[model samples]
Target chain A: MPPEVEGGETTERVLQILSTSARLFATTGYDGTSMRDIALACGISKSLLYHHFADKDEIFARITLGSTRELVQFVESRLPEGAAPSLRIRAFMAATGEYFQRYRWAWIASTTAFWNDPQQRRQTERMLWRDRYEGLIRRLIEEAIAAGEIRPLDVPLAGRLVLSALNWMHRWHKPDQGMPAPEVAEAYFDMIFHGLKR
Target chain B: MPPEVEGGETTERVLQILSTSARLFATTGYDGTSMRDIALACGISKSLLYHHFADKDEIFARITLGSTRELVQFVESRLPEGAAPSLRIRAFMAATGEYFQRYRWAWIASTTAFWNDPQQRRQTERMLWRDRYEGLIRRLIEEAIAAGEIRPLDVPLAGRLVLSALNWMHRWHKPDQGMPAPEVAEAYFDMIFHGLKR
Candidate 1:
């Protein structure tokens, strides 16, 4: 095999392990899941798994880091350059809900990892992505206010409210049930932009 | 001591243990905390602690149950016999924010427990309170719609959004920090009632 192809295969194998591990961890939880379980779930030997990850925590950390990075990138990628602030906010929420729906295990694993493990490295990485994600939303809201699209309010608190509503989607959103992400996002945007009052 | 006073003292002691355990659990997580740690924190013997509750799980269950009941009662108490739908919704959010602030530990413990442990009984109990709480909010929203106070939207999704914003308060709301519960509630209610539009 060519050198680049060999490297690509290795990367694919590693991603496969991480994906399987995330599913297992999401269902059984981090503490309940074992390395053997992950290896078994991935249909790989324990030795092969060890070759890729030092241990379960390493696998978990990698999964969380990758998932967070992917979510931020996905949302950022969805935004058009020089978009209006309202358009930016709408795109962000719609993309986020869709991302969570498509990558349910990643969302669950990343969320669980942040709360379950307080290791310094994991904490720093989690906070980095969290701050970036929240920062983007805050900036959009600020722009909206500056442009006179939305009324001025407590910026930090408003950011928290917006992010909280979006993040909570993972908990109740089921792809097979209820409104799809696009419709849900529309409802959210409508309520958010128009308030509940008639 | 009189029988009633003796019973009250025992109840108080149990509550004290639970309160201390909740604080420890919130700070150190459930797995990080032990019976010995809770006993030591409560300045009581392990036997005395066991006498009131069978185990840590039992203590946790009682704490969660009590906290849920108290929150429901508090919110209920805050509403008058026949208030406006908007008033009812306002009372619910304000009371919930205040309840979370006052019993921060309970909120932390209960949330952590629901996510960390998948015990059937605990799941059922958590859902019971959650459903009741969400149901109340949904009913209030429905009433608001009928009263023509708020425009019709996805009721369930709106409930989730509202609850998410309020629940997320526990993560960021510090009594000694930036915005107090009432002020935060005001901001939330305002944003919730009126859209971001100028």
Candidate 2:
């Protein structure tokens, strides 16, 4: 009945539309899902979906931005200020596994295989984790070498490899398979943290 | 000029078709690629392309089967008649990175992302890498621990985690990016073989 009430309802509806769209996209996939599917899944009209998102990519970008925001915030908190090379490296690798479980997004990361193929759409979301964290790992690697914590090697390469190992876990890990998330995180840590060599 | 000429021509054509198809599928992705695309890329007639492989899936299967064979053979050779645990584990991890690089269809391993989705037509091709390599890694983990090479942990989880880390390199690694393959392998090996703790 009132303009303010109408505006509030429209914004709430738009949020509802995006929240549902993201969950579906992350679970099903970006290409596999249809706008109609999102509309039906959301129990909303197509026109209402349009009012919220210009197209699938619009909704996808919004959802991706939302996920990245949470991820950036999580990284900000999980990584402590001025932790040591050994501790920071552990945290860095652990963040990979832990973040996936925390966000429930290994599927989203892997399915879209976001790093490759699409050059520009929503590129900022993909870089959020790497840009925020790789520098820290690079510094830790350099510091660790100087402190004799580990061997001298390229920092960025190691960062990518470590991230790859953690990111790839989403391809095989099924929470329903009785595999504990902490165990996966710990095993990865144990193997890489101490080296598999005796 | 008869049998030998025909046999050589057949094999050449087959190999040509396979390389073209693999490149196309790897670049454009499988769903976006069609018989026409492959044929056009190779400048071969559709009828002749049919002679080389029955369809896209058949060509795709050949690509996968070939990769699986290469990977399995490499690991099997590495696991000698009486090879030591340390050597076997190192060689296994090394071979994995190499094998993943060789195969164009390695992206198929990201099936869980699109598990229930329609593009997952080549599910077997994707799962085979994990099934074969994870089994081999599990055996290696057990042997390595028995031989006092690794910390005590669940073998299966350790194996999957290790494979996840090593094989997932394809996600970020591009040969054109100036990162050498050996260096990448060693970067992982450094973190894995020596660790970061002081």
Candidate 3:
């Protein structure tokens, strides 16, 4: 069961727990982290941590599900309605990068964690959210193709090409490095949209 | 020191040990796997496993270094000496796919392992090989730009764009699944070479 969110205080405390857990999981990796470690990191007693989360797996599941939900909502909020397909696609990429930068640790934890455990409800739900995100991108590409803004190519392949560049950033894109995530995403957008032909 | 290879039989036995260890590390993850587990999986005694290598770290390091060396050689051997920069890039990608298929587990383990382990010699050496591989691609891009075969752009960024798509494949591309890696790579190459815009 999901943790109880009794009120603002309880919700905030839960968020704090999740935030600390995400950082631990992101840096040390899921296997290396434990509930005891999370509690210690959060300066809470083990009983208190367990009061909020049943176990490490539940905490991880909560973080992954919450991160993906926020990602979808953030991207949807930024997508411009009635804009050209290409602009909409660029907007999608930019919004994704912005979200990633804002929640770098949580995003990393969610993306890199092993989510294929046997028929777990939380894992299944997270996959559904991921599918929604992918579907949204595919629809944008399909719209672009139909409008003749882009070449008529394989829709799934096109979607993967675009998503691959954006998705792989967490491995290399430093949080406070040379360029911000959104700008780096724009560079990728330019490359994908404009062929390298001189 | 590296494992001793006294003769052809010893070399083959070491290869067998490395191959089994690679598959375990690839599937169970480096941390999730144990030296004893590797020995059990290999149907060998713990003493025999210890005789081959010091520990799991050494086995992982050997697999990573060997896989990278083979990758460099395979890509270089496939590269056409006088071909256009574009064709050469395509060849480089195709060769990577072939190598990946041939040594799927080893490639997966090497690429996904946490290599930044505080200045260990094997990890450091593996990073050097990885750098060499990246440098090869960057030089190829530089040649393409100089030859006027492609638009002059941020060479590193362009290289990242291409590598990201190819590198991200291990996550979603299953062995014996929908499309072969080379064909998938070709589609990516086409989309990257000719921009999505008509």
Candidate 4:
């Protein structure tokens, strides 16, 4: 009896479960958290937890897949279609910041999930979403290079340079403290887009 | 009983334990790895393990602190004495790449250890080392700005931009797989130093 479109209380409970589970996963690591721990933290019974998820992997998959899907959709929506690749790249950073701020815990948990782990790599669907997200950036870089808007560079490496800054934000960028996420993203983008050299 | 000024076999054994533990910690998260697991994985009796490390935190601190110390020393040695900030920054990246590849597991496990975790923050000594490493970069950036080698920008953010690129290397840059680590670092530095814009 996995969650269905039976909105209202069930939806609320599911969201609660997902968020709580995400925090635990983020702090404790995926292999560290158990369904029993999740249920205890969520104030739900084992039976109820089982009713919602087949097991820990199912819960993990649901949370990670959902987060990735939301991120992809959010970034996609922000891109100015048919615009210059540089503009789209800017949008990508801005959108990442907004999305990260809105769902800090889940976003960090999902993105930081160890895809290289042998067990995790088995999640083929999740890997596909990751590829899609990474591919989008690489494609934009390629387009920019082709159009002569940006200097020719290694597309894959270029994509990594842009993403590494945004992905590592959670390490230092405190939410609701210091500069906002969007501005930090903008600053990083500016540094990357315009050379730091005088 | 903890490891002290012992050399020869004792030191070799200690090195072996630290590396094996780093792999487990990196894959399983700090909270997830137990002393028993480490002992079992190392194929040493739990008593012998305890003789070498009082507890998990001590082992963890040893690994992280040692790695950071090595990293700082390596990077510092590479810095051309009194060189321009730009040249020093390049050395920093190259050193980081080389260090990362040399101690791949321990380097990553040490650097990625969650300092933000409340429990981890109590490791004041570890935090100090981290600050020192980061401070070195910040100071270099500040000097560059003062010397007008680079445009004036947020010093802290500039440091993050530089570090984020290096710190996130373990994610995609495989050791001995494709492009060499130093070259990858050089390429990233080039992108940051020279704007992507044509």
* C-alpha RMSD of each candidate structure in angstroms: 4.0, 5.6, 3.3, 3.7
**TM-score of the B chain in each candidate versus the native B chain:** 0.91, 0.78, 0.90, 0.87
Clashing pairs in 2: A165-B165
lDDT of 3 at B195: 90
Better of 2 and 3 by TM-score: 3
Comparing 2 and 4 on TM-score, the stronger one = 4
Judge candidate 1 against the unseen true structure and give its global Cα lDDT, from 0 to 1.
0.78
Sort by TM-score, best first: what order? Answer: 3, 1, 4, 2
* Residue-wise C-alpha lDDT for candidate 4, range B1-198, written one tens digit per residue: 123312344476787788889888776767678999999999999999998888988778777777777778778889998899988998899988988888887776665576333245545766787788899999998888889989998989989998999989988887669988988888888899887887
Per-residue lDDT tens digits for candidate 2, residues B66-91, read: 54555666667666557776567767
| Winner of 2 and 3 under DockQ | 3
DockQ of each: 0.63, 0.54, 0.64, 0.59
Looking only at chain B, model 4 earns a TM-score of 0.87
Off by over 4 Å in 3: A1-10, A115-119, B1-10, B115-119
Docking class of 1: medium
DockQ category of candidate 2: medium
- In candidate 3, position B115 carries an lDDT of 27
Which tens-of-lDDT digit does each residue in A89-130 have in candidate 3?
999999999989988888888777752332278888988988
Count of clashing pairs, candidate 2: 1
Write the number of the candidate with greater DockQ, choosing between 1 and 3. Answer: 3
